[model samples]
Structures are given as C-alpha cells and as structure tokens.
Target: MRHIGKLLLLTSLLTSSLAFGQITADPEERGERGAQDPLRSRTPEGNPLPFMQRLRFGGGISGLSIGNPFSIGVSPVVAYQASERAVLGVGVNYVYTRLKLYDSAGQRYNFTANQYGGRVFGMYEIVPKIIPNLYAHGELESISVQDNYSGAGLPVNRTWIASPLVGVTYSQRIGRLAGINLSALYNLNYTTSSTQVYGSPWVLRISFF
Candidate 1:
C-alpha cells in the first residue's frame, strides 16, 4: 500500500509539471508576449512589417548669400532600414553658384557654375540602447564641377571628382514613420584649392525623413 502511495505522488507531480508547461507554452500567449516587446520587429498582428514600411525618404536644402557669392543647393535621399541598427541609402546633389570676379586687367565679370553629383551612403546606430537617436554615417560621392584650373578668363569645363565623407547624425523622431536629422560630416578628399567643389571640408545638413 505504501509503494502504491509513493507511485501516485510521483505521478501527480509529473502531471502537474506537464500541465503547467502546456499553459505557459500556448501559441496565443507567446504571440501576445512577443507583441508587447518593443524590440521585437512585428506588427500589431504579430506579423513582420512589409518592405515598403521600412523605406525612408528625406532631403536637405541650403542657400547662402554673402555679397559677391550666391549659392543654393538641394540634396535628396532614399533609404532602406535594413535592420534595427542599420540603414543604407542613395542620394543626388545639385548646387548652383554665382560669383563676381575681377580679371587681371581689373575688369569685373560674373562666373556662374553648376555642380551636380550622386552618392551612396550607409549609417549605423551607435549604442542604441543608451542613445537611440545617434548614428555614424559614411558616404562615397562622385560630382561634376567646373574646372577652375582652366584659368579665370578662359572658357570653363566640367570634370568629375570623387569625395569620401564620414560623420555623425542626430535624429529626432516625429512619430513612427517620420523624423528630423542633423548631420555634421567631413570630406576626406577635400582640397584647399580652386579645383575643389566645396569651399569647406565640414558639411552640415538638416533633413527630414
């Protein structure tokens, strides 16, 4: 009789454990738990978000007027969120500049130029758990600019130049799908000469996404 009682106690403990596991392992319960997790990449229905939902579009515009020189530029970008921590994009650039110059003979003239380019870029989140809005950025660009080496009075020609840039971005989310970003970047291939398209190595951009 004692042996039968011991067997019954062991069977009861095993059955209780199996029942508890079944309760905890229900698919609906697990799905609800996963949906509540902020880090999980899922929709309200516990389905993965579509590709179009992960795409981001943004651009920046700039204008400068300082006496003899006037400049305006636009840069537009289309990006894809590859993961929670990474983004990849492509962009185009257009800039119009007009400058008043004095020839060697003391004659004043106007120089109008157009600079256009395209770039490929990538960004990675930096310590996202601690600072979710900060990102590290890198880009490779090829631009066409006026060949200033042709001398001040000669007819201008256009040439392609390559620029590599690295920087950081601070992004502020407006809602789930929109945000504003400020980026400060440095051009590694910048030169301090007339052939250079940009006057400065430092480039600051404010964009919307």
Candidate 2:
C-alpha cells in the first residue's frame, strides 16, 4: 500500500510540472512567430514636397537696331527648376550703346556706358502636345543705365527703367548636353520713366541637356 501511494504522488507531480512547462512556452512560441503579422511587414504612406532641379548656366549677346539708339548687350541667365511644370530664374543684362540724333551732325557720341539689371521670373507649363512642353512666364525687370557721353561730345541720354514681361517658350531635348528653346515675349511699361518703348520680340535658344 505504501509503495502505491508513493507512485501516485510521483505521477501527480509529473503532470503538474508538464502543465507548468507548457504555460511558460506559450509566450516564447508567440514571440518567435510574431514576425508573420501583416502589420509588421508594411509601412505607412504619406506625401512629400518636390525638390529643385537646375539646368545649364549660359551667357550670350543681344542687339537691337530698329529705333532709339543701336545697343548691344550681354546677358547671363541662371535657372532652378521648382518642378516638372515650373522654373525659377534670375538674369543680368548690360548694354553698350551709341545714339544717332536726327538733324544733328559732326556731333559723334561715344560711351563706355551700359545698363545693369536684375530680373526674377517664374515659368509654368500650359501645353504639352506636338512638343515636349510649352510654358509661360512673367518677370519683373529693373534696369539702370550709365550715360557715357555728355555735353559737347553728345546729348545726355535717358536711362533708368522698370517693366514687366510675359513670355511663352518651348523646349526640346536633343542629345546629352544639347537642347533648344523657342520663345516669344512682350514687355509692358509699368513706370513713367520709360522711353523708347520696346515691342514684342522672338528668340531661339540652344541648350545642352
């Protein structure tokens, strides 16, 4: 009888130990398999702002001879892309000129004078057919000219001016480091000091991609 009792107690103790072991293992097994959850495999989605894209830096010469004084100018442009449809740009232009006065002879004017100016512009894409793009931009231009000849040499010339301009442009990519721009622009007078008004002009620019 004593031996049977001892055997029964041992059996009960073994059963209790087995139950405790299973209870402790439940959490560890869940932890090892937790990576299979769908939430753990995916990330949240959100929106972000676009970044800037910069194009080429270029300098070129421009001239006009129709009216007023014949002037030649050097202009340089630096541009940064705001998005696929927009660009932010700034430019500086300097002009050297000689004015021909009607009814005045033997009075030749010479000037080392020029205009110093800065402009800020924003361009937006409006059409995208038959070409890679078509864009329109508006700009504010402030120009200050230094008259090089005065008095007995030549008559004093009018200088400082500010105006607004609207333009349309198209661009096509050629090869690496090569592209082209076709553009037209109109200048509007916003200040009283402007004389020898300028009209709309067309331009074509070649670029490198």
Worst 10 residues of 2 by lDDT: 17-26
Q: Could you say which candidate leads in TM-score? A: 1
* Candidate 2 C-alpha lDDT tens digits along 97-157: 4455544567654323445687777778786433435778677777785444333366657
Tens digits of lDDT, candidate 1, 12-120: 4432322100001235644654522132234545565566766676666522223445455566677776665677888887666666778799998766666788989
Model 1: lDDT equals: 0.63
What value does the lDDT take at residue 45 in candidate 2? 27
TM-score of each: 0.69, 0.56
True lDDT of residue 12, candidate 2 = 45
lDDT of 1 at 111: 66
The global C-alpha lDDT for each of the candidates, from Candidate 1 onward, is 0.63, 0.46
